[model samples]
Target: MTILLFGVTKDIIGSSTLSMPSSSEFGSKRSKTVKELKEYLGKMYPELKKLSSLAVAVNNSYANDDTIIDNFDEIALIPPVSGG
Candidate 1:
């Protein structure tokens, strides 16, 4: 399974693709929800706790915390996008 990070998350994670732990990968593994993934990331980088206001996407569409992630799904942790 792969988790993609975009925008500020990309900067924080230092990569686009995140590989899950061996134990978390298995048949039909859906190891995380948007909120869970955010908390896990905040644990890794405490600074991110201040930046929790995010728009998460699963398969290119905005996802709520209740959304489930399957191995085949594309997950992207993207912050709100703006341009001028």
Candidate 2:
């Protein structure tokens, strides 16, 4: 699955695209969800753990981690923004 990282989240992971394990089995398959992906990101980029209330979006629609995602899908975590 292709994860679309935005703002600080993108900086945490360094690169945009990521390929982490989704299952326990060896090279079983890829998994996409708010929770699963969180774990993946936490490992790939531990900096995310410090943030709170990360907004998960699927195909531009705001969604939860439970939402099923596809390979061509676009997922982004919208952290809070500040305006002066």
Candidate 3:
């Protein structure tokens, strides 16, 4: 799966896009839900866990923790944005 990163997420991940292998290819370490994805990422990049709030988008719509994800889905990591 390919995840699009924005704002601080991009900075933390050190890239605008992150590619992850499918569960079949990655054995059992692949993320199958939004919650798992968050945990997976947090472990790989602990800085992500420091954010006050992190939002996830799947196929352009907001997704909850239980939201199921697949290799073909379009995912994005949107960090908090503060401005006047």
Candidate 4:
């Protein structure tokens, strides 16, 4: 799976995009839902857990934690924005 990162997320992850193996093998660590994705990322990059808020979008639409995900889905991480 591929995830697009924006704003602070991009900074934290040190890249604009991230890739994960698209496999559903018994021992594969692929995320199956939005919530799992968050947990997976948080574990890999603990700094992500420090953010005040984080949002996820699937195929350009905001998705909830229960939202199902697959390797073919387009995912994005949106970080909080502060403005004057």
Q: Which one wins by TM-score: 3 or 4?
A: 3
- Give the TM-score (vs. native) of candidate 4: 0.89
10 residues in a row with least lDDT, candidate 3: 22-31
Better of 2 and 3 by lDDT: 3
Leading candidate by TM-score:
3
Which window of ten consecutive residues has the lowest lDDT sum in model 1?
Answer: 21-30
Order of the predicted models by TM-score, top scorer first: 3, 4, 1, 2
What is candidate 1's TM-score against the reference? 0.73
**lDDT (CA) per prediction:** 0.72, 0.68, 0.90, 0.88
Our model 1 lands, by Cα RMSD against the true structure, at: 3.2
lDDT of 1: 0.72
lDDT of 3 by residue, 1-84 (tens): 899999999999999999986643332654478988898899899999999999999999999999988888999999999999
Error of 2 at 77 (Å): 2.3
Candidate 3 TM-score, true structure as reference: 0.90
Candidate 2 accuracy as TM-score? 0.71
Decide which is better by TM-score, 2 or 3.
3
Poorest 10 consecutive residues by lDDT, candidate 4: 22-31
Candidate 4, 2-70: lDDT as tens digits: 899999999998999998875523115544788888988998899999999999999999999999888
Model 2: residues with Cα > 4 Å off, grouped in runs: 16-31
